[model samples]
Target: MSLKQSPCKDEIIAEAKRLGFYKIGFAKVRSVEKASASQYADWISVGCHGEMSYLDRYHDVRNNPQQLLPSAKTIIVCAASYYPAKKQSIELPQIATYALGRDYHEVLRERLMLLADFVGGETRVCVDTAPLRERYWAVQAGVGFVGRNSQLIIPDAGSYFFLGEILTSIEFPADTPLTQSCLECGRCVDSCPGNAIIGNGAIDARRCLSYLTIEYKGDFPEGFSLGNRLYGCDECQAVCPHNSTPIFTSIPDFEPSDELLSLDKKTISELTPELFSMIFRHSAIKRTKLMGLLRNLKALD
Candidate 1:
């Protein structure tokens, strides 16, 4: 398929909404903006990425979308709220809202593939793991601004959303980047139990509770407390005043499960490998694996 001269922005956005995406934006595929690239290099150089060596391993491909899709000409970014209307027990082991239901990678990928088909083009799909700096392009696409806590904060949607993109060969006029930024509320900073927010939208993943819970492959590092979190952490987003009126997701795939909302220390401690595999079969919590969840539970205990 060849690039069309007309802007399909409205049509594409309409389809995305029909598909349940809450936010949508577009950007021409090109090298990542120099400022974002530089900041990433600095973050990695200072070892802020911690054991997530994959962030450094794919530096070139991540900086330039052309490397991932040689024929790609545009990026269609979309985000969906995962915030649930119901809250889990305060005393139970807490899980991130994003992980409460079906795995976003599965849910978002299916929707993105449908969106890609709607665009009628040669394309590639990306979720969180795909080496692409999604939040960076998401900002360029005008979906939202990078908050001080390093989350892509969409207006009204808050930061409790999942982002996915379809890299397409079809070209479209790029959306103007958003001029808005957070009010520098410092609430997220003051609220962080791990002090992971190192300011200026940068995070020391080594100290990030979310990173430590789900991404770190080893035991909890010395001096880091797991608190009550068993899978991922949402302290930064939870404290943001913008999230006070969080728009709950209508997507049933993002709803929390009964087991997740009722998970207590005893339940978690009793999880065997077999039961863990069965219960978390399609949950993002599977990313932590049984061992990692057990590790976090033990640390919190």
Candidate 2:
């Protein structure tokens, strides 16, 4: 049904803000067009996905929302700022800002469920863990523009945010997709220490530090070191000029716990599986598992 027949768009946006999302937008569910489809195929063909075989799973659904859920009529895209008010100690083992707090999969999933309830319709939520191309939908929803770094850069909040989506049978008013493009500023390309980010809005995931820390399971590639990162890396975001004025999150759940922010190499090195489980029980770091963390820490040395 059309949004006019259901909840008003303004009310939906207001509920999103009240639910702690930084921004929200809607888009019609459709297939990935020629440009996007070709780019995705090229990225995968070059083996940039690394050992993440799942990226190839559900080929149809990954490229088309209709294939994911046939009744899906619209995509409700949401963003949550994870920029921390305080930076972690330089000497401490580093975790990506997104993982400093509770797992976003949990936080966003719960919030999306609430949003679905508010909209009162058949709905499904897809966090990063899903096979869907979230940034593509975010762009279609007019929530943000893709940056040269291949990140969804929301106008005011920069790229330091997590994106989530709700696939529902109800359609909503959609904003005109943003026309802004990166200033042809090659800053992200020059700043990538691993030479991961390629041309504008394209990334070689195999060379990305974030992927290396979180998804790569075996030994570090020759000449590649973890630097100070132990779980996930944020060097690209750290250097982005757009992220200079960091947006602080007021959501209590997004705040980094003191223990996690203060974890030292000694503490991380001494961690057993059980200890790791306890420490990251509710954190996204669990995606890498204890062994992955240990592998990352050893690479740093």
Per-model lDDT: 0.87, 0.83
lDDT of 1 by residue, 74-117 (tens): 99999988887777887888888888889999999999998888
Error of 2 at 169 (Å): 0.7
Local error of candidate 2 at residue 147 (angstroms): 0.7
| Residue 163 CA displacement from its true place in model 2, Å | 0.6
Give the clashing pairs for model 2. none
Top candidate on lDDT is 1
TM-scores, all candidates, are: 0.95, 0.95
Residue range 215-256, candidate 2, lDDT tens digits: 887787666687888877777777777787877775678888
RMSD of each: 2.0, 2.2
